[model samples]
Target: METGERRTATERTWMFPPVTGWTFDQVKDLEVPFDWELVDGVVVVRGETALWHNHVRGALVSVLRAAETGPYAAVSGQCVMVDEHNVVKPDLIVCDPRGLDVFEVECAPVEKVALAVEVVSPTSRQADRVRKPALFSANKVPYYWRVELDRDQKLAVHEYWLNADTLTYFPAPSHPVHQHKLITELPFPVEIDLDSLVGF
Candidate 1:
């Protein structure tokens, strides 16, 4: 008997093969029960985001699309290829309008992304704050914003801008935390009422 061996399914109802690492293009085809991402050649599954998290994403999408002064547009949960071995699905992405039609794009190239946003929740603290920023910054996504539930349990926005040379994120210089209203010219000039996310 060998330590590592295979098992026969026989007449089992369902069997999932042992798989490791998935390319960005192949991820969309996986019919799994939960939302997922591919990291380090493995499919990592996490429960779906909270309802409030999605509501905030939806609101930002509308705001960014309406405020677009360029050819970029906002979409929620679009898969992005971070590298040959990694694919990330951001909570929201503002990206170039090209190659965005259905049947045309399975996952967006990292170069096409303008901004990536993550709305922080308890379950996603590490992924949103640490892992995602590191990945996005290394890939040179122009901007990243983290929407958070602050100490008062009210929504706030933390903005980060990427430095191409260092491959890292620096907090936007002026405001440490953006709440109530967020007005910015970078990443296509979108204005949003942060508090409005909860009204949905």
Candidate 2:
């Protein structure tokens, strides 16, 4: 019979042995330092975010939360289960309040999400620009927003609405409140001040 200490050592050694082909549930069970997303049974690990990244996320969340009305609330860094095989954590999400229970810890179902937003980062550019948008659209998420900060720190927001018939996103024109503000009406009426957000 194996001793307790011996068994503990063996378990620890094999605990995180290669996560390839893992399901969202499996990845969720692990003790990982960084957020993990399972895309097509492959694990995508997120790196540590920078100060600017966090600042932008905070400003965006504040804007959304302030404008939120009736049943929808802005949440940050929450895992969204796109399907059994795919799970992703968007930078910011606006979701139905009923779908989330503060007492329980779990990923929000994709159906409960009203809007998904990804703020571009150096490490996440490709996935944010391509994979995530496609996944959100396929799951019939009503709205998607992308925030891009250029080299000169100029901010731009791209909004898209899901076309139910085609199950794809069609770009929606952003309503500029002025030289520094961008406004949108979907999900809710919200205006973001790019100059203040980026310290321009």
Candidate 3:
């Protein structure tokens, strides 16, 4: 029994070895349990999501899905190919419905995505707060939202819209943060009541 238990643990612990200088194709071919992103030829494995992460993500996805009218659809944990060597999976993504398949095994083109949302987890703070926004803006993703859980466990939404000329994000000229609700016109009109949405 002890030997069998040890073998089981070892088998579960075995994972695809991380590689440097990998392209999107190489990363995609890897059969790992965790989602992966190719960041400038380096493979970054996504951390396991926690309960609160899913709770916040579910709330946002529900709102976005309900508001979906035409052409646009919202999804969670879909990969977006930024370039030949960059693929990222946002927590929630809103994009052309035609671009996604039933299972979402294939990555959606960055150009087709209207909004990319990241719900910050303890391990994902730096990447979500800094790296992803820059990458999304550089790819002209048009809209970006960062959801944060405050000390009091209330959700705070940070909104940004890409500046076409500069290819960077600027706070939506309207309400940008923690206004109890978000009302924006770009990527089509969207109004969400944050307090109620998060059940806070």
Candidate 4:
């Protein structure tokens, strides 16, 4: 008979926000769960963010909807994928219209996305700065944005690409942190203001 708390090795489950690894059938079997991202076969649930984080998130959504005008679509805190075990929920996502397949009823594939962004929540900063970039680069994602909320008592912006090993951030000589955008070669080019996004 089982004893000592009856420990059992449970197979881990993985997912990329909104859509989980469980098929519709598997999902139906689950009674309770929260949003999560599976990276390197490890499942990591998104941590609850600060009010400032939420404020920045909502602000970005608003800016994308109201100020930045273009054919692109902006998504907030939606889980996306780089691979089966590598899933992420970006604070804000700006994608090319061509990548809409990922947002379909069935959801899009990993490579379909053009850009992925992460807002630096007190809890998520390390994963964003260290873990995600390598995964994104390995997957050949063209662009990535990292928003830092704790530096100098103000918001800081950073951007990366698969081509470079290190990340280049905002407050650029030509573009201030607020003026940066995630530009791409897609037919309908779209950009987001980093400063305005996190509410500087």
Candidate 5:
């Protein structure tokens, strides 16, 4: 390694003030400069998402926002407190916002969230597929969706519903893989044209 070599932002490690006894309430109150989430009561900072990921999220959010009827609305990047120790921020959340201002909500209760969505990125494949779904299922989030982009950039959507008896996610009646259209009615009636989501 050369002393003069420059490191990219992603290559550099950023540190926050060292502290212990980090609770969700305490961590939420602290003034932090970057995006972070609570995993087992520890603060894990996240890297910025890629543009293609953003394209899928924004496009899908727009579709959900329009498809959702009455009290429901698609809210992006909201924190759902999984428990006392785990707090996860899903790419999108759908909930009834009849009483409160959804925009002003920083930490949303799992009971209030009807559905959670995640757009898979290269760096987050493991978390998106395994950890996030487990957390959401354990917390009893009613519905969950995982969006993926294949090698040719064709979109794929995976849908799941919570099994109350088991407290885990069960696959939807059908799974429409690569470049297929997804039409579902559990959480809400939404016909998702997977190809339409990945324009970039």
Candidate 6:
């Protein structure tokens, strides 16, 4: 099994920190400023999410906090398992607090989450909207949210939920805070105020 000191390197590929048989404790003790989410035995690091991305996160966190009361927790920006080679660092994650245990060094065994949110940066829009939706659904996460951002701190909220055949997202009806567009499926009803979310 690979250890922190034995990380292998290859050109032009994202670093795949070796943790083949390392314990969660070993993953956490690594000397790095970035937060990591481990799936199977691979490490995924999160780059800086843009400022507008954060603003939208704060908005949803407020709504989620007000409407629910339970042991479940809502967090913005954390990595969770998507599959053996695909570890995803969602913009926001809401899951059982008890499951934080799964986030140890080399693995997190969570399969479901109360909610998952991703705010789009130009650099990550493709990954956020297309890549993650498939991964989240394949893993059966219950709820997924996408917040799209454009110049001037403008934004859009796209909500997704499980559908019988595939995961889908429902875009807002009015002109988007940033005029972004999407398609989605949300089992529970949601009233998204696009303007307010982007400080219009």
Tell me the lDDT of candidate 1: 0.77
- lDDT by residue (1-200, candidate 6, tens digit) is 44364543323222444545333444544556666554455555556766656777787667565544566666655556555445567777777666455545333344647677887777677778787777777777776777766556555565665553665443334422323333232323234555576662
**What's each prediction's TM-score?**
0.85, 0.84, 0.82, 0.65, 0.83, 0.63
Candidate 4 lDDT over 37-112, as tens digits, reads 6555445667887777788778766756554446556778666655544557777776555636554533334576
Candidate rank order under TM-score: 1, 2, 5, 3, 4, 6
Question: Cα lDDT of all candidates, in order?
Answer: 0.77, 0.78, 0.77, 0.56, 0.76, 0.58
Write candidate 5's Cα lDDT for 1-200 as tens digits: 22212211122322322233245764666455778877876677766888889988998899988898877878898888777567788899998766666567667878788999999888778988999888888888888889888888788888888999898998876653424688888688888887877765
Across 170-194, the per-residue lDDT of candidate 3 in tens digits comes to: 8877667755777776566778887
Ranking by lDDT: 2, 3, 1, 5, 6, 4
Clashes of each: 1, 0, 0, 3, 0, 7
Native-to-model Cα distance after best TM-score fit, residue 169 in candidate 2, in Å = 0.8
Q: Could you tell me the lDDT of residue 192 within candidate 2?
A: 80
Which is superior by TM-score, 1 or 3? Answer: 1
**C-alpha lDDT of residue 181 in model 2:** 71
Candidate 5 error regions (>4 Å)? 1-21, 98-104, 176-178
Candidate 2 CA-lDDT value: 0.78
lDDT of 1 by residue, 1-200 (tens): 21111322112211332244444444445665567777865667765677877788888888888888667878887888777458888888988877557577777889999999998878889999999999999989989999998777679999999988999999988865788989888887667888887785
Measured by TM-score, how close is model 5 to the native structure? 0.83
lDDT of 4 at 47: 84
